[model samples]
Structures are given as structure tokens and as C-alpha cells.
Target: MSFYTSLNGLKNAQTDLGVISNNIANAETNGFKKSTVAFSDIIAGSAFTNPKLMLGIGATVEAINQNFAQGPVEQTGAALDLVVNGDGFFTTRSAISGDTLYTRNGAFEVDDNGYILRGGNRLQAFPTDAAGVVSGNTLQSVQVPPTNASGAQFAGVAVGKNGVITASYADGTNVAVGKIALATFLSPGGLRQEGSANWSATGLSGTATYGEPDSGFYGGILSGALERSNVDLSEEMVGLITAQRNFQANAKAIDTATQISQTIINLRT
Candidate 1:
């Protein structure tokens, strides 16, 4: 039992170290969130003449939850780059699986075909009327029309505070393409991580509700900027140190258990 107990502690410490290491590694990743390791204890105790004599068996990992706190806003100055100034996620769809994904990585660009993409996912948006008002609940792909025969290119793209995407042509023509849509969840922290800095909705997170930025519960958009990773280097370093000490202590306990077992064998001899 002592050996098993110490072994579980060793495993727990290793898991903690892994989580901390990952946070440290992704400190520079855009829109990345950190996760913390959780644990629960098991008991070997049974109802006996003296219940106080019972012992705890070992510890086991309970969950690894992500910290969804907003990351620092960084000024990138790129026309396509964006950051959420308030509280929502940029909606995207995976080209491969066609699954709807949510992300905070607003670094986007229009492809050759004029379709906006991020991480190979088509950026989703809502159609806006000539008055720049969102017209319907239907989500459409954000598009920037190609240059015409006169070679009048899309000179610039602007995402307003309210999430309207307007493409300005070189000929001084402004066209309202599509409005970037933001999605809010009942519990943002409950979103399940889908790789590439994306997240998937879960039962805990509930279905995402889409709306224009700064309207209703969705967050406003900040153009020419991006959100940095929320991981804190100093905190992760401290956690690394703590997990190391725990591992060492568990190793010591295992060694002591071995020594005690040897002593008992010697006495029998």
C-alpha cells in the first residue's frame, strides 16, 4: 500500500509538470489559454472497530481545466489582424470536416478567391444591409471581391467596433461585404479545446449564440490588433518548481518504504 501510494504521488507530480510545461511552451502563442491539473484522493479505509485507523490509498487526477481569462491585447497594426475588446469568439468553420469552430485568434486574411480564412477555416459572418445593419440570422462566409478589369484592387478592409466588414476599393468605392459575427457561450470556460487554438462547444459550454460585436452579449472587435496568450511565465515557473519538489518527496517516500520492507525481511531471517 505504501509503494502504491507513493507511486500515485509520483504520477500526479509528473502530470502537474506536464501541464505547467505546456503552458510555458505556449506563452508566445496567440489566443492560447493555460490549463491546470486537478487531483482527487482515494482511501483504503473501511468501516472497522476503530475507523480512525483507516488510511488514504492514493491520489488520482480529477480533471485538467483550461483558464479562459482574456489574454493581453497586442497592437499588430495589420489591417486583417483583430482582437476582441470585450467578450466573444470569432466564429470559423473547418474546411475539412465542415464543423463549426470558435477561436480568439482573429489574425485573418483573404485568400486568392476572396474568401477570408484563418487556420484553413472559413471565417463566418452575417450579411449586412446597405445601411450597415445586420439583416438576417444566417451566417455567411466573409468575402472580399476580386479586382475588376480596371485593376481596382481592394485597397483596405475595415472591421468596425460593431463587426461590419467593409472593403474599400482603390477607386474610392466602399462595399459592405459581410459583418464578422461573434459568439458567446453560457460558460466560456467550459469550451472543449480543439487544437490550433480553436475550441468546440460542449454540453457544459452550451450552444453558442451569435451576434454582432458590441451588441447584446457579444464582444466588440478591435481592428489592427490581436490577443496574446494568457499563459503567465512567472507563474508557470513557480508551478514547475513545486511539481519538482513533490516528485522528489514522493520518490523519497518510495525509498523509505523499500527500506522498511528490507528491515522486516531481515527480522524474519
Candidate 2:
């Protein structure tokens, strides 16, 4: 019993170590969120068993909760580099399946076809009217207008505080591309993590409510900057040390239990 209990403890520590290591590895990744391991104690008991005599079997991992706290902003001076100052996620779409994805990574680039993209995924925004006005409650791939019909020069991109993106031509004329819509969930923590710093909506997360930045529940957009990873190296290092100690202690406990069992077996023989 002691051996199995200690083995379980070791496995739980190993799981925690994996989570901490991942956080440390992504410490410099943009828009990365840190994760923490939660645990639950396992007790050996039956429905008819007395509570006073119930013994703890071991510990098990409950969940790996991710921390979505706002990371510090770094000024990159690049026009397309963006960050939200409050609560909201940038809406993006997978080019292959057109599946909607959300992320805090506002780093974007304009493709040769004038479509704004991140890792080949099109960034989504509300469509704009001819008067350079953004129409609400709709989403489309963000497109940058050419400075000229010839498509020779790159148009200047400007994102406003309210999430409106405008394309400035060389002729000093500004065309409203669209308003980059932000998505907010009732429970952001329930959002499922996808690779490449993206998250997908889940039933637990509820439906995402799309809105303009700085309006109602959405966050204000920060242009010319990016959100850094939320991982704290110091905290992660401390956690790693704790996990290592726990693993060692459990191993030692298992060895002690094994030796005691052997001694009892020899005495009986």
C-alpha cells in the first residue's frame, strides 16, 4: 500500500514538472499563457467504510489551469504589431477549413493579395461601407487597399483605439478597411487551447460575443505593440524545485517501504 501510494505521488510530481517545464520553455513566446497544475487526493475507501478509517491512497492531477492574466506590452514600432489593453481576443480564421480561432497574438502581416494574415490564417474584421465606415455585426477577412491600382507601394496600416483599421495611401488619403472585431467569452478560462497560441470556443466557454474594442465589454486595441508571454521565470523555477523535492521524497518513501517489506518477508521465512 505504501509503495503504491508513494508511486502515485511521484507520478503526480512528474505531471506537475511537465507543466512547469512547458511554461518555462514558452517564457519568451509572444501571447503565451502560463499553466498551473491542480491536484486532488485519492482516498481508499468503500461506501460502507467508516470515514475515520479511510486512508489516503495517493494524489492525482485534477486539472491544468492556464493563467490568462494580461502580459506586459512591448513596443515593437511595427505598424501591424498589436495588443489589447484589456479583455478581448483577436478573431482569426483558418484558411483551409474556415474554422474560427481566437488568439492574443496580434502580430499580423499583409499577404501579397492584400489580405491580412497570421501564419496563413486570415484575420477577421467587420466590413466597412464606401464612406470608410465600419458596419457592425459582421465579419470578413481583413483586406488592405492598395495605394494605387498598380499595387506598387505598401499602404500604411493604422489601427485606432476603437479597433478601426484604416489604410493610408501614398496620396494622403485614408480608406477605412474595417473595424477589427474583438471576441469575449463569459468564461474565458473555459476556452480550449489550440496550438500556435490560439484558443477555440467550447461549450464550457459559452458563445463568444463579438464587439468593437473599448466598447461595452471589449478591450481597447494597442497598435505598434505586442503582448509578451505571461510566464514568470522566477515563479516557474520555484515550482520546479518544489516538484523535484516532492519526487525525491516520494522515491525515498517507496524505497523505505520496499526495504521494510523485504525485512518482514525474511523474518517470516
Candidate 3:
């Protein structure tokens, strides 16, 4: 029984090490959030057992909780690089799965087709009129308007702090293309990580509440910048050391238990 308990401890220590290693590995990944391991102790006795005599079997992993604290923002000077200054995530549509995903990674670029893209996914936004008024609640891909038929050449595009997108023409005319949409959840930490800094809403997170940036509880967009990974190397290093020590202690316990069993077997012989 003691041997099994020590083995469980070893397994838990190994799990902790793996989680810490992953956090350390993604320290430089943009918009990466760190995760912490939760644990629960197991008792071998039932409720009828004496309270003071109940034996602790081992520890079990409860859940891995995500840390959603804001990461540091870095200025990249790239037009499409963006960061949320408060709370909220940029909504996007996955190209392969066609599922709606949310991400904090604001690194985006306009494709030759004039569609704003994050990787292969299309950034989602609300349509706007020429005067920048939001047209409706419907969400659509953010796109740059093509050159006007009157011969005005497509010049460039700009995004406002409020997430409004505007396209400019060589004729000095500007048209409101769309307003980028941001999504907030009741429990941000409950969102599921979909890798590549993207997340999907889960029942624990509740349905997404969409809104424009810089309005209501949504965060304002910071163009030409990006949010860095929230992993702290020093903190992770300390956790790594602690987990290693735990692993070693459990290994020792197992060895001691084996020696005691061997001695008893020799006595019986």
C-alpha cells in the first residue's frame, strides 16, 4: 500500500514537471497563457472509518487551470499587429474546421484578395456603412474594399482603436469597411485552448458576448503591437525545482519500502 502511494506521488510529480516544461517552452510564444496543475488527495477509508485512522492513498490531478492575466505588450510597428489593452479576444473563423474561434494573438495581414487574415483564418467583424456606423449585428469577415469603379485606386487600410476598419483610395476618399468584433465570456479561464493561441468557447465559459472594442467591457485595440506570452521564466524555474525534489523524494520512498519488504522476505526464508 505504501509503495502504491509513493508511485502515485511519482506520477503526480511527473505531471507537474511536464506542465512546467511546457510553460517554459512557450515563454516566447505570442499571446500564450500559462497553466497550473491542480491536485486532490485520495483517502482509502470510507465514511464509517474512524476519522483519525483513515489512510491517505495518494494524490490525484484535479484539473489544469489556465492563467489569463494580461501579458506584456510589445510595439512591432507592423500595421496589422494588434493587442487588446484590457479584456476581450479577437474573434476569427477557422479555415479548416470552419469553427468560430477566439484569440489574443493579433498578428494579422491582408491577403492579396483584400481579406484580413490571421494565419489561414479570417478575422471576423461587423459590417459598417460608408460613414462608419455599424450596419447590424451580423458578423462577417473583415475585408478591404476594392478600388472604386470611378478609377480611384485602392490606397491602403487603417484600423482605429475602436476596431473600426477604413479603406483609403488614391483619390483621398475613405470608406468604412467594417468594425472588428471582440468577444468576452463569463469565465475566460474556462475556455478551451485550441493551440496556436486560439481558444474555443465551452459550456464552462458560457457563450461569447460579442461587441466592438473600446466599448462596454470590451478591450480597446492597440494596432502595431502584440501581446507577449504570460509565462514567467523565473517562476516556472522555481516550480520545476520543487517538482523535481518531489519526484526524488517519492522515488526514495519507493526504494525504502522495497528494502523493508526484502528484509521481511529474508526473515521468512
**Which candidate order results from sorting by lDDT in descending order?**
3, 2, 1
* Model 3 misplaced stretches (Cα beyond 4 Å): none
Best by lDDT: 3
Clashes of 2: 0
Top candidate (TM-score): 3
lDDT of 2 by residue, 1-269 (tens): 89889999999999999999999999988998999999999987789999999989898899889889999999998888999889999999988998999999999988988998899889999888744577667799998866645454554888888888888776666678888889989988889999889999999899999988888868899999999999989999999999999999999999999899999999999
Per-candidate alpha-carbon RMSD to the true structure: 1.9, 1.8, 1.2
Q: How far off is model 2, as Cα RMSD?
A: 1.8
What are the TM-scores, per candidate, against the unseen true structure?
Answer: 0.94, 0.95, 0.96
Clashing pairs in 1: none
Better of 2 and 3 by lDDT: 3
Candidate 2, position 154, lDDT: 53
Candidate 2 worst ten-residue window by lDDT: 146-155
Cα misplacement distance, residue 172 of candidate 2 (Å) = 1.2
Q: After superposition, how far is residue 82 of candidate 3 from its true place, in Å?
A: 0.8
Candidate 1, which ten residues in sequence have the lowest lDDT sum?
43-52
Worst 10 residues of 3 by lDDT: 142-151
Look at candidate 2 and give me any clashing residue pairs.
none
lDDT of 1 by residue, 89-168 (tens): 99998778999999999899988879888988989999986447778889988878876336798787888888888888
